[model samples]
Target: MIYIVLSIFCSVTVAMLLKLAKRYQISIIQAVTINYLTVIVLSLLFFKPDFKVINSSAPWPIYIVLSVLLPTIFLFLAASVKHLGIVKTDIAQRLSLFIPILAAYFIFKEDFNQLKFIGLGIAFLAIILTFLRKTEAQSKSNKWLYPIMVFIGFGVIDILFKQIALHKELPYTTSLFVVFCLSFLVSIIIVATMVIRKKTKIQLVNVGCGLILGVFNFGNILFYLKAHKALASNPSTVFASMNLGVIVVGTLIGIIVFKEKLSKLNYLGIALAVCAVILITLSQLNAV
Candidate 1:
């Protein structure tokens, strides 16, 4: 439980910091690059995961897919943030959870019951509710298409994570390191493309901010990896819980810390997310 909560906190903090970075006038690409590098260093120096588990033939797809996928996902997410505000963009992205749960059921042979079904429905409703806009600006800007594309990408990433965790014998940290390492390489290509197009430059601010985010981001991944390992049979549940927990914490931060308001439906959406996690976890595992 502590693991799940801490992971959620890290995830939320990452967002809040990124939001803060915008005020600092940092480029999103540079910020992302810095964040990933910081995570890579911490992973190498502190975690010391045994990466050999991912070396075998079995780990190939998980290793290869995430290696290529995440850099693109991060960029797409940044774009989504730019086009859409943080709340709607993220709430829209919650759709990413669907694939992993469905994939687990079919590919991993995970099982559940009616109660779980009810819970999932409720949680999803909550997420949608949270993004239910109060202002004309937010309502007019909610583009379903962009976020749908991003959702598919993130969904695939989660499937890969589930596969790597269940089949690969490597320390979860090792798989993460490999994933981040690949994310780094791919991100470089992305950065080069941006440079070639003369879209942006990596100012020192970007580097500095990226470093801080990277450390926290790496820790976020590590913490979630350890938690999933503990609840390996139903890691999708933990993933859902962690994100939903972020929503719970994020909403509070939005309200208390940021003085963000919640309409009637938004509060309902938060409730839905929480309910769905309970259903998803309990039904999926029958363990909670």
Candidate 2:
């Protein structure tokens, strides 16, 4: 339980840093790349995850998916930050339980209770209500398409992650390293293009933030990997609990500290979001 709580804390902290990175003039893609780079370096130094497994004859598609996931994540997350604001984007991203839940149902054929499905329904509605704004111009409605696209993109990522988990041939750490390398290379290409086009400058502070993001991001992965291995009862429950906590804590901080505007509907939506996790866990109590 402590591990679960701490994982949520780390995720929320990362979200806050991503939100604050704007003041440092760092964009979201740069922040994500920096964050992943940080984790890769840490993985290199402290973790020493089994990297040699890549040479094994596991399967090529897994590596392909791993590579694709990196760039998709970087781009999807950046789009989310741009279109939805940090808080809503985080909610939408974390609230992507639908993808995994459904995937789990079809792929692993995991048993699902009625209440968990009901809770998923409510969580979906909750996300919609929270991002409402008074005027069209003041709201993220202008760039809403990006967030929706980001949602679909990340949903695929989470689903693929589950597939990766179920793969007997692929270990998690090797998968992580592979995905990070691919993402890093993609980021370099992006940065190089920007440099050639003179679109954005990669500043010293951006690199520093990337370093910070890397630490937290790596820690995020490392801790979750443990939790995944430790809690054998219900992985979905853990995923739901950790991510929902992120939404609650992150949304509170966004409102209290950053003065994020929310309508009555939005607050109600937030409440519903919280209830979704509770209900899902309750539905899974039999398994746990």
Candidate 3:
């Protein structure tokens, strides 16, 4: 329970940091690059992953894909927050759970009970309602592309992480280290290219923000993994709790701290999202 709470706090903190970054006019790319560097350092110091275990037969392909996708999605997340506000962006991110659930039904042919099906239905409706805006100008200006990409990107990343978890040859921590290293390397190349093109200048402020972001970012992942380990047999509980916790907490923070405005329909969508999570959780309990 403590692990779950810590994970939720870390997750929300990362979103909050990104929101603050936008306000401070920090460069997202530079911050993300430095964040990856911090992640690599922390991963090495804590996990101490053995590099020699990595062989030709290792899951390099998945690692490579994740390495590329992680930072890319993170950038999209920042953009989503900047354009769509934290409330909608957070909701869209939490809704990504639907992607893996749908994949299980189709690809893995997992059994879906009535509760799960109904929950999925409500989740779909919730997404539409959550993103719906009243004014035409607001709708036109706040492009849906960023949040849409975040939803899909995070979902795909989740699926890939699950695949990595299934592989027993290498430790999850080691795999994480490899992914971070690759991601950092890729970031270095991107930053170099930007420098050459004179697109942006690197500043210490961005690096400082990235360092703080990195701590919470890694904390979110680490504590979530710990919660999973603590509740090994109840993965669904962790999954539902984490997603719902983020939505509930993030919504409150956005409204209270940032003074983000939402229509009544959006609030109703949030209610439906809660129901969807509850139903999904119940379905998991029933399966167990």
Candidate 4:
């Protein structure tokens, strides 16, 4: 329970940090790059993952892909929060659970009971409602592309993490460390290219923001995996709690702190998101 709470806090803190970054006019890419560096250092110091266990037969492909995808999706997440605001971006990210659930049914050939199907249905409706705008002008200006990319990108990242979690040859922490190393390398290359192209200048403030982001981002993953380990037999509990907590908390912060406006339908969509999470959780419980 403490792990779950900590994970949720870390998740919201990441969102809040990104929101603050936008306000401070911080360079998102540079901050993300530095954040990856911080993640690498913290992961190594904390996990002390053994590198020798990695071999040709190891899951290097997943590691490499996740290395790229994690930072890429992080950029998308920043863009989503910048463009779509925290309320919609948070919901879109949480909704990514559908991707792994669908993958389980189709690729893993897992059973999908009636409750699961019903839950998926509600989830789909919730997404539609969440994206619905009150006016055409607002809809046009607020491009849906950023949040849409965030949804798909995070879903794919979740699927990759699931694969890593299933691999028994390596400790999850080691795999995470390897992925972070690769992600940091990738970020270094991107930053270098940007420097060459004179696209942006690196600043101390961006590094500072990145350091903070790295702590919260790493904490979010660390505690989330801890919660899963603590509740190994109750993954659905972690999933539902984390997602629902982020949505509720992110919505409040966006509306109250940021003063972001949401229409009645958006409010309803938030309500439906809670319902969808409940139904999906019930499905998992029933299966158990």
CA lDDT, candidate 3, residue 133: 88
Candidate 3, residue 64: CA error in Å?
Answer: 1.5
- Candidate 2: list runs displaced more than 4 Å: 105-111, 136-140, 233-237
List ranges where model 4 is wrong by over 4 Å: none
Ranking by lDDT: 3, 4, 2, 1
* lDDT at residue 202 of model 4 (Cα atoms): 81
* Highest-lDDT candidate: 3
Residue 232 lDDT (model 3): 96
Candidate 3 segments whose C-alpha is farther than 4 A from its true place: none
- For residues 1-288, write the lDDT of model 2, one tens digit per residue: 667877877777777776776666786666666776777787777667675666657555766775666666556666556445667777777766667777778877998889888887887887688666668676745566555665666777887766676766667676767777777877777878877899887787788888887777777777776787688666776777787778878787878877777778878877887888777767777555
Backbone clash total, candidate 1: 8
Tens digit of per-residue lDDT, candidate 3, span 1-288: 899999999999998999999678898889999999998899988888988989887788998999889889999999888777788899889988899989999999999999999999999899989988889887886478899999999899989988988988889999998899899888888888998999989899999999999998999989998999999998888988898999999999999999988999999998898889889989989987
Each candidate's clash count:
8, 3, 0, 0
Q: What TM-score would you give candidate 4 relative to the actual structure?
A: 0.96
Poorly placed runs, candidate 1 (over 4 Å): 51-58, 79-95, 106-109, 134-151, 226-241, 285-288
Candidate 1 structure quality by residue, lDDT tens digits, 113-185: 7876676577567656766677887677646455556768888887888677675456666777877887888
* lDDT of model 3, residue 112: 91
What 10-residue stretch in candidate 2 is worst by lDDT?
A: 76-85
- Per-residue lDDT value at 235 in model 2: 79
Per-prediction TM-score to the true structure, in the order listed: 0.82, 0.87, 0.97, 0.96
Estimate candidate 3's alpha-carbon lDDT, on a 0 to 1 scale: 0.90
